[model samples]
Target: MLPSGTFVLGGAASGKSAWAESFCESSDLTLNYLATGQARDAEMDQRIKIHKDRRNDRWQTIEAPFDLAPALAALDGDSIVLIDCATMWLSNHMLAETDLAAAQDDLLLALQSCAAKWVMVSNEVGHGVVPDNALARQFRDAQGRLNIALAAHADLAVLVTAGLPLTLKGTLP
Candidate 1:
């Protein structure tokens, strides 16, 4: 059987996405990269391009910047789905001032019922010093809470640093 799900967290530049990509690509199954990044600037565009170059055409990329739950619903049962980076997705929703609570609720429901191997990537924003701006602080806390909730439901939780992955909870199968 599939090893349930994994919620992976790390800081910026951490190997979290790379590790998740590796996990998905190593498998012989059809791969799905659920990209959450939206090219808001040139830097971001370059980052997205770098990620794209790292993968071969064998992997299918789905650009779901928001309403990620619906994207999950549309996926067939046979793919290895890796949602690369949740922070960007959260930021995207926040930019639209979307209902965070409702989105998370729908996401949890989708995750629980999804009959596929899912790896969610998020930035662990709570580990560092608090941000100076109130909005930044709120974003940090909200992202942290989101990660915590996902980790609780995930069969595996991983913390990545220095290109290495440390299993925080559960086993890899």
Candidate 2:
């Protein structure tokens, strides 16, 4: 069977995206990198460049910072989609004051309708000190909820720590 949906969760700089990329490379399908990050600052721009440089030219990159669900829905079934990641996409919606519940529902619906194999990367944000500010706490909660939901929906789920993969749900394909 084609890799249906795989979720990769990890803390910051935990190499989850790199793992997901390599996982996609295991398949022979057309590779599609759906980037949800925006170059909002110099540091982020440099980080994005590093990520871009890591991928081979065979990956067709799609910038979907604000339109992840729609972009995902538009992909062909024969493609292997790597959404690296969902955290930034969530942040974008939160910053825009969008209805996150509704947005998440839409994203899940889009995923249900999608035919391509999916590898989704997201930050595991709940394993740290509590934020002092209300906005930060809210973001943390939302991210946690989103992560749980995605994990439940995924055919396979893996947690990355210290650059090691630990399968949480189904076996790695």
Candidate 3:
């Protein structure tokens, strides 16, 4: 059986979201997708469309670009949520100039108290070269911290590289 929470970590185009989606689909519970990405430009719009095309009628998508706690709280034990992912969620918060610590705290609390099983997808940003700008550096630092926290809180943590999953914390179901 899948655990209460799973943290899926990977680099860009590492197939983490696809793996997570498959994981959730294997579960008998109702599937809920908590999308955190926003299409602010043409490239992003195309990306969103591609993701949307991959999911069928079985997945009920909730768009929470900035705030996710409320949508996460609304799920019940019969549901399995795939938050794809934390990287975009953090970016949204950072761009909005929100308090990162408080926002992260709220997210963690909500995930902890939520009744439904959940899988969170996050990018492994620290593997890349150090960014040159202040804002980029800040985002990298924040993403690293968030990933650490999520991994600590999750019952199962998996790292996806080149579409392969390596268990980091718990046994894969």
Best by lDDT: 3
Query: For each candidate, what is the lDDT?
Result: 0.85, 0.89, 0.94
The C-alpha stretches of model 2 lying farther than 4 A from their native spots are: none
Kindly provide the TM-score of model 3 when superposed on the true structure, using C-alpha atoms: 0.98
Q: Write the per-residue lDDT of candidate 1 for residues 104-163, one digit (tens) a residue.
A: 888888888876778899998887777889989989888988998999989899899988
Top TM-score hit: 3
Question: What's the C-alpha lDDT at position 132 in model 3?
Answer: 89
Q: lDDT: which is higher, 1 or 3?
A: 3
Clashing pairs in 3: none
Clashing residue pairs in candidate 1 are: none
The alpha-carbon deviation from the true structure for residue 164 of candidate 3, after best TM-score superposition, in angstroms, is 0.5
lDDT of 3 by residue, 1-173 (tens): 89999999999999999999999999889999999999999999998898899997999999999878899899999999999989999999999999999999999999999999999999998876888898999999999999999999999999999999999999999
